[model samples]
Target: MKTIASTNSSAFGEPGIFRGQARFGSPMLSDYVWPLLEIRGQRPGPRLCVSAGVHVNEVSSIEAAIRLQKLFDPKAISGSVSIIPLVNQPALYKYSEYICPIDGKNINFTFPGSKGGTFSEVLCDAIMNEWCAGSDCYVDLHGGDLRENVSKFSIYQRTDDAGLEAMGRRMAMCFDAEIVVGLPKDHMQRPGRPPTGFARHGRLALMSEAGANGLLDESSISFHVEGVLNIARALGILDTPMSAFRNARVACNDYLWVETPVDGEFHAEIEPGMRVTKGQRLGAMRNLFGEEIAEITAPETGLVLWRMTHPSLPKGSSVLAVAVEETQVGQA
Candidate 1:
């Protein structure tokens, strides 16, 4: 491979680091670039790629990626680590919009994208094809957006590849979040496949979520930073032992999405990570005159994975996401 910033191919075989930008095409006014950080260890091992800011509003993940870039030292690792701290610079620069303003599409839904497609698609294409083509592992960091309040959790795909699935599970466990979700083969396939679409193309991939509501809480940021370091230790990239969290990891095989029954101002009575029983009241919707328009109830007993942070709710808008715990099928 060719060299870009400071480090060269020789550094890939020895301890060194490189910092540069992966340039894509230009917009009307300025050039498009994704900041890239590459760290090569003294000993050769797996190539672990970490990225965040796919959803620009997920600021905690972005900050975690930034902190992780400075924490890793090439002399202390056994493999290479590549980090893209902020993936959607345009969206991020545009006040943390959920979708790219240029194309009005969620970049996370566009994977293995087309070079000739819209702005988001072209950006995804460059990242997947040029930056993350071959890798032993991949972690897409995310958190709740400006209008999302969510608990910390990690998700991994339950794939046909046993080895890849196992690796993904281990990485998820290493994150040690409050919950570990196993997405089925067909999870989130509509609109477009998630970034985990890389798994179908033969890469061990996982995603971590923390922080929410466009706030940068230090606790949330620390959780993500520690999760990445824990995964590194699990992968043997770092010699440090795994650190345990307070809660035992809970596993979920599916999620239930609750949508608003009427358009009104929403007031959530429950928070993420809270447990709810079937038929329990989760929140309520009120009309403009402050009259109760509808009551939001839990569909089943489960943990609240995420809740809508926005005060106003439109009819049919998703307000809460509950992760249903159940039996584990197939081989781990």
Candidate 2:
């Protein structure tokens, strides 16, 4: 249930920020506009490329990207900031879930995009070549989609490049979330699997996720805004005080998704971020007649990070996720 929301069709048409569209050579996308905002600072420094709405119903990230346009002054900023508020414009237009509606492709899996590919591939290719080309910091903002709920966290990768890995960790910690999740770079670089948010850029790439259930929650939006600002300040893009990554209380080695094995209505007893012991009953699945069909329990003793918000669950759907195998990262 979202209390606040943008009353318009697209946030791009909002008054505060409007840079011309970044044209991709896609005839299928000729009818729509791909929103791009560039803010060049008076001073020279590192460039930052931030993208949101890779999953269209992740409204909080999209809203944060839109707000970032007017949050900083061009004169105070160093170098520039490139923001793509809504990457899946068609999906956003139709309120589609994770995949792009036009091509039914997950933008996350397509990186170094192919020019001669489908609409989704072409659009992502443009972004990869245009914004993620150089030594710039790339951030892919994401969160729970229309039916999912997520807590605040940041993700970095364990890439082969130590320098890039260190920078990614620092960037992930800048989000000031209690948890920082790490993924194997080999997994991201390996083909045939979901690439996990274009992290294979082989640079300072990370992800910030907050807000959930397709809501425009102010706190979640601010979480993203402040996190990006922290990174910008740390990278000298802004004049604000630089706050390096220091708030991570736990750094997990992996994040696990819990899939429902049966089709039923879900009843979750625990909210995200709750700490539960192994085998704790997190929830239960019931048929339409209210007969319990399955029991949902914590697979491990760790923090529950996210879950599906909608009650209806189909077998094999990712209904919950947990942060497991963690180590104490920072001071409490």
Candidate 3:
């Protein structure tokens, strides 16, 4: 890792800024610290902020951030690169929860939060005021929550706004994830949206899923590391080739959710990156007595993008897949 001074302030503190957990006091656990590496290049460029561990258990992104920080030399970079690997350190450490242990709030959903709120919300506000709201671009790193493993992919919001789309697409190309999922809608309108979640508006942000939940998978880790490098190069921060870009960019607008018919022991017959047809049986559910409870099928022809790894589920638990069709409403 690149050795730099670790100071205890966000700005006006030091150049090699490593702000330790500043006290937000009791009502909010200020334990979740923000680590930023401000490498001012010889020439100025766009500010890129990469955040990981917002969900805690999705450890790949955190590892990727560490690896990138070490290998990332600001002298070689064109602009600033800020990284907050453990955004939800409370959850990652104490409770070992996917969401924040203090309040069970998802850090991702609690963005642009209030100053005097709960731990997660306050941290969210701090992050917004300290990191995200100021940056030119933000990359929210995530792995599939708990049971779900994800294909190497990034998400971009698809809207009529072309500028946002362009930025997202460029980052997607640099990251070169297996597929690029488009999230057109914001988190608020989302049926089962988490209270503290990502903003689904006109923001220049991208979500990258590296591997499964819980542990660090090497393959996914390597991909994430390389993905960051690729983005750096593509954004003109590093001198390199963009040929590392791999996988097709699948839009989120062209995808659909695969839900379970009834609550039971869910199983998946297909993996995240598999291609399937409309009538294909993606998976099934069974009861405690080994009796088949419900059969899950694809609604349309497309590729299986994500599925639930947690089998013991409740009613309406999203079981298997989001498919991106070859041709959809708008593909040009």
Candidates' TM-scores?
0.90, 0.85, 0.83
* Alpha-carbon RMSD, each predicted model: 3.5, 6.4, 4.3
lDDT ranking, best first: 1, 2, 3
Backbone clashes in candidate 1 total: 0
Clashing pairs in 1: none
Q: What is the RMSD of candidate 1?
A: 3.5
User: Which parts of model 3 are misplaced by more than 4 Å?
Assistant: 1-32, 95-97, 112-118, 185-201, 330-332
Better of 1 and 3 by lDDT: 1
Q: Candidate 3 residues 215-310, lDDT tens each?
A: 788878777787777777767778877555557666544557777768799878888887777788888899999899889998777777778888
Tell me the tens digit of each residue's lDDT in model 2 across 1-332: 00112343223323232365666545755666666776776577787888898898888998999998887776677777878798888876688887888889887766656778887777766666655556368788888788888878888777677787778777777896767877765566543122233455555667888988888999889889989998898788887885444444467766777888899999999988777777899999999999999999887777888888899989988778888745532313
Count of backbone collisions in candidate 3: 6
Q: Per-residue lDDT for 102 in model 3?
A: 76
Candidate closer to the true structure by lDDT (higher is better), 1 or 2: 1
- Please rank every candidate by TM-score, starting with the best: 1, 2, 3
Predicted model with the maximum lDDT: 1
Best by TM-score: 1
Model 3 lDDT-worst window of ten? 190-199
lDDT of 1 by residue, 49-142 (tens): 8999888888888989998888888889988889999887877668656787778888877775676778878776666666766777778888
lDDT of each: 0.78, 0.74, 0.66
